[model samples]
Target: MSQPQGFDQRDDQSDRALRPKRLADFTGQVPVTRNLSLAIQAARQRKEQLDHVLLSGPPGLGKTTLAHIMAAEMGAEIRETAGPLIEKPGDLAGILSSLKQGAVLFIDEIHSLKRVVEEYLYSAMEDFRITIQLGEGATTQALTLTLPPFTLVGATTREGQLSAPFRSRFGIRERLDLYSPDELGRILARSATLLGVAADAPGLATIARRSRGTARYANNHLRRIRDLAQVSYGNRIDVAVANEGLAMLGVDAAGLTELDRRILGCLATHRRAVGLKTVAVTVGEDEATIEDIYEPFLIQSGYLVKTPTGRLLTVKAYQHLGLTPPEADENQQRLF
Candidate 1:
């Protein structure tokens, strides 16, 4: 396949290069990090390399950062690639064969790899060998190439879609959970210091609460707020300036963006629970994006609930929208 432009390709290599040097710098996922640290230390003690690792999580949750950190700590050369980029088996073979000893091959979105390419990876990951067949005749022979003892770090957002056999190959498999408000606040403050932005306590807290507990969202909000502050007022970002910036961006104090409001509005106004399809259509977002990006935060914040019937707006959501809950809802709540 021809190379796709603007997919996993960005000009922010400098920012990417300085994400985190060690596992300690890569924040969040404490349990996974502790387990992985133990595994790495044990491998080092045994004078053997760590086994293949699989990180499953939503996007922007620091899978790539952790991969780089692992390579840095292991003192190995890192080769980065994505699943879609490796179209053919030869593409993977060439990359694997060129690796130096103990190199780290980080493949992001590993679930997208073609079946043929994935099959080749299974053998390479297990036995450090690749079999290439030559000629079409009955006398055709299979040539086996020995690969260096390297690590394959696969990151995927959809772990369920991965084939069972493929999923079983990784020695370490962990999921990155969504960050809490406190964790996101710390991340925002850290990134703010690095970006040379003076954010007060209230400003940081506001951004953190409004960031929906995602470090990427928090960082992006800070960037926008900083730009707004620089343009409208002085470069200093205080609570007032932050609130003004967020208001102009249509993000409320509760971290409910305009789209989020629309979703709740539909559910509240309809006076009944609605299916994901209906919610997506009303909000003008794809169902998958709603589930992956927006719904999780809303549900976690007590603004929405996934019922057996469908998506229901909670009393808090109704209050946020300046609406009152129905008597039936109140009675049902009391009975429950």
Candidate 2:
């Protein structure tokens, strides 16, 4: 995992406490909320289980929160697990067979599931049953298990890694996008109220703009700032305190963390399109972390661009890094 912006135990607890339990309470991802609301309403009216759902997005975009919200809206008990945890077909069979009628089975990082386990899930998702082979010898017998009518809510940061067959099994699919500053500001305001911290509009806005367009980061920053305010500012947050707290955390004005700048600085040094492997090695992070966590915000904020050849830093990236942009070469000028 990427070091900067990664959550810890306390942040996880805070996230759970601050997550909105109902669709109406959700702050951003308007289109996704609307689609889920319609599906939930229809499901409730028909007195049938909600269809399997696939929620895809970068981390901290509220995919897991939405899965919980969906279960809440459907009045279904939800069993949570990660894709890697269910290592064997028997493990999956046990969980599937144990769900109550109309429950929601939420799997985080669903794209990482082993292929055999994923194939084992196909039957349960389609027919509410799974076939398991008992005994691994000539005496083995096929045992088909009937499962309860439950919704499989899968959350994935790398949705493309999932097989086409697995992706198709989810009838209601939604992709969450990064939040706008205004939406993040609203979310922070609510979080402030919940956390019992007195915060000014400017303070919240400052934190929001520095949140990398993710609610989790906004709330995480709020909690940390709240700590600073409690000790030094009489439990009050203003722009100065917000900026001070964020700076202490190594978050710059553009919401770029130390790792983010390091990645950009690497690209700036190259002054050309650098492949993912090179960027990963130069930044001392794995390729997946750079691609999934850091690259999304950089690309979305117009700081970086992915080319057929490799990843290139844009003029905005150079400006953010306090460096001059280099003139493009003949073959690469078109990229600029």
Candidate 3:
């Protein structure tokens, strides 16, 4: 799909579904968007290239899309790769040496790079030069290759895992938060029109509320609902069709999936705040997976809350599950 300014070719259909062409098309992330705009404008006014950028966020939140936008804004060619794909330092060296002036090297999942490979990147990012060893002999000499000025756009889901040296190299650091329900609803409505799917406002609202503030999830649900409408009713998606499709997919009114229900069940039945580790153990999932994949949505929907002590169920959580609040817990009662 054609991206706005700074993106490369996308492989996933969902990426194309909500990919914003320019800064204006990208929804939500008001502060980050504003900051990026200023940075781009300042760079253009100086007639210099933009600095290297690092985007940290959960998956499916438009890191890749924004990278493409940055490239477009600069009118530069983008070369895409992942950190894990660069097995040796030479792999990254070759790609870096090939970059043209003002090119963008977009590296996804950048926290997974090996220490040696990461060391090589430090010099490349700072001075745009790669040192090569000629031979292991008495006459061995070091050859330094100076590269054209380029930008590195790195995306990572786990910012904490990146070493301070690597993180500090990025001139611009932006964090992406989950979108609001209203923002997601607009995204769904826009996508529906673009994809030629006929959906009413109510239908789009239903998809957005249940999307857990994720544009990718909203688009995915809309596609499923459209399929249901075509097969069960006609090829039109309205409120009734959206509700039926969501019900069949086992998504609750608040957009909690089966895993979310399981987490809430454990918290409510225990009648105490539970640690994330214990909750992950009980659910048979890793702590990182739970935090990165499931907890954001549950927390946003008011189905879960992280206290100083541990994870607690909110009043809305009990009501959604059709359960009475425990009488003895003062905090739970007060929350209601």
Judging by TM-score against the true structure, name the best candidate.
Answer: 2
In model 1, the Cα lDDT at residue 336 comes to: 7
Cα lDDT computed for each candidate against the true fold: 0.81, 0.91, 0.83
Model 2 agreement with the true structure over 167-260: per-residue lDDT tens digits: 9999999999999999999999999999999999999999999999988888898999999999999999999999999999889999999999
Model 3 over residues 1-336: C-alpha lDDT tens digits? Answer: 112111123326655755887888888899988998998889878877789999998767889899999888888889999989999998998899899998999999899999999999999999989997778889888999999989999999899999999999999999999998899988888888876778899888888888777777777778778889888787788889999988877788878777778888888887768899999889777788778777877887677888887988877888888898666455553453
- By lDDT, is 1 or 3 better? 3
- What ranges in model 2 sit over 4 Å off? none
Q: Which tens-of-lDDT digit does each residue in 95-138 have in candidate 1?
A: 99899988899999899999999999999999999988778799
For every candidate in turn, the CA RMSD to the true structure comes to 4.0, 1.3, 4.7
Clashes of each: 0, 0, 7
Better of 1 and 2 by TM-score: 2
Spell out the clash pairs found in candidate 1: none
